[model samples]
Target: MAKAYRKDEFEFFQNQVGKIDQRVKSYLEVAGFEKWTWVYAPVNRGRMMTSNLAECINGKLKQARELLIIEFLEEVSASSTHIYSIYDEGKKYIVCLDRSPFSCGRFQLDEITCERAITVLKNKHVVDMKPYCSEYYYPEILRKTYDQSMFPMPYKKEWIVPQEVIDEVVLPPKYKRQPGRPKKNRHKK
Candidate 1:
């Protein structure tokens, strides 16, 4: 395989999907089941197709992408705290599930998704992981949590300015500067 083609992610995925299909066929035939049918459609009739071999391949790809290979060591460098956290709690966070912990009831889950990463990176095989990798899917709450954590400043949702602020603050800014204190007007009797 040429390096150029390897650099194109979709091309890489297509190739990977092919390779896995072949492996599954071989493994099944070798086990004396020349033909066996399993579920390819993802759960809930969504596009989230699943096949054991296919999932394995996708997972490997994600782990490789996570490697963050850099031109220099510093290129891959991140805060020590984060790196340590991944070294420590990441394993559990990535622990394998009977089925992918992240797969959901929605239409988006696929054979290759980040939620299923433990299956690929857990074993540290990237080629095997490719099919399973997409930015790990998150539950809505987790997605919100992740958004909050990653954003240094939370996005301030657009809102109606308080009427008090608009009427009192911004609208009253045309104060004319008086040269001296206001002179008391003398009433002529």
Candidate 2:
């Protein structure tokens, strides 16, 4: 489970962790780990706790700014003595999930375009895009969702697609009109 940080948590942790937050967030951004679909899953070790430990180091350094080199060296040696013990004792794993730094919310797609996107996405093993219409989003699912007569694809296999599908599949949501019953003409004798 992820920990929800209220104002106090963010403030307190940020202050205590100092430069750690900025550094970590910057690193994550550079690594392209800035999407909602991007998850930081380490089987062990909480990064937050690591930041907190680094914070402790920063705190000691803050206090010893005037200390002699010999004294600082001794403190550094002492600090590193049991770093592994601190690491091994953590009871919970910390995983961070970043959602949507790579948004594609307002994108559109058509039948042929969507199939091509799906094929490309399947080829890429994954994709992070939003289909503007439900029809274009899930062609197969939309088929099941609506009557086949209402929404039919022209091509059965190898969805025909040009380079620009998003532009091609742009349509309004309202197409249903109560099936619009056909009228019969009455002739008078």
Candidate 3:
């Protein structure tokens, strides 16, 4: 029901859900169709139709999560023709290689070529995706960021502290730990 892009499609799924469980259907209705159903949504959600964005991202990062930080960074360092059509997971996506804003919304939002754009770029035999990325990620820009020399701090006794700052007392936060094994996974938002 959430994936349906047309009223008829949405209605069909809605009926199916109603048949399975009227209570679920009523709950969905009470929550508002616009909140969950694509057809009723007032704004474009792009290709992100999943119920939870964090879950979707977590799924995509499942493999990378096990890798070391440097290895993960290396993997992350790894877009497109004028336009192309892509089909994945029973959904069709339009990727615009020549400009900003692909159907997935990632290209425009992150200022980086998304997987769809990258596929289009590969099909078009285009190399060097650096041009598709934002200037912030450029080698020159990154180099400029740390061009200045960074010095280490002197001894604590050499520091000039403000009277108010020196007198201020900092306390640890009061937290009651739950009685159970600590969770290895991050808390979902």
**Residue 107 of model 3, lDDT score:** 49
What do the candidate models score in CA lDDT, each in turn? 0.39, 0.39, 0.68
Q: Write the per-residue lDDT of candidate 3 for residues 96-134, one digit (tens) a residue.
A: 544544565554435667787787788778888887778
**Model 1 CA RMSD to the hidden true structure, in angstroms:** 28.2
Can you list the residue pairs that collide in candidate 3? none
TM-scores for candidates 1 onward, in order: 0.17, 0.20, 0.48
Q: Which stretches of candidate 3 lie over 4 Å from their true place?
A: 1-81, 179-189
The alpha-carbon lDDT assigned to residue 110 of candidate 3 equals: 51
Best-matching candidate per lDDT: 3
- Candidate 1: tens digits of C-alpha lDDT, residues 82-147: 111123333323222323433221113343444334433555544544334344443554476657
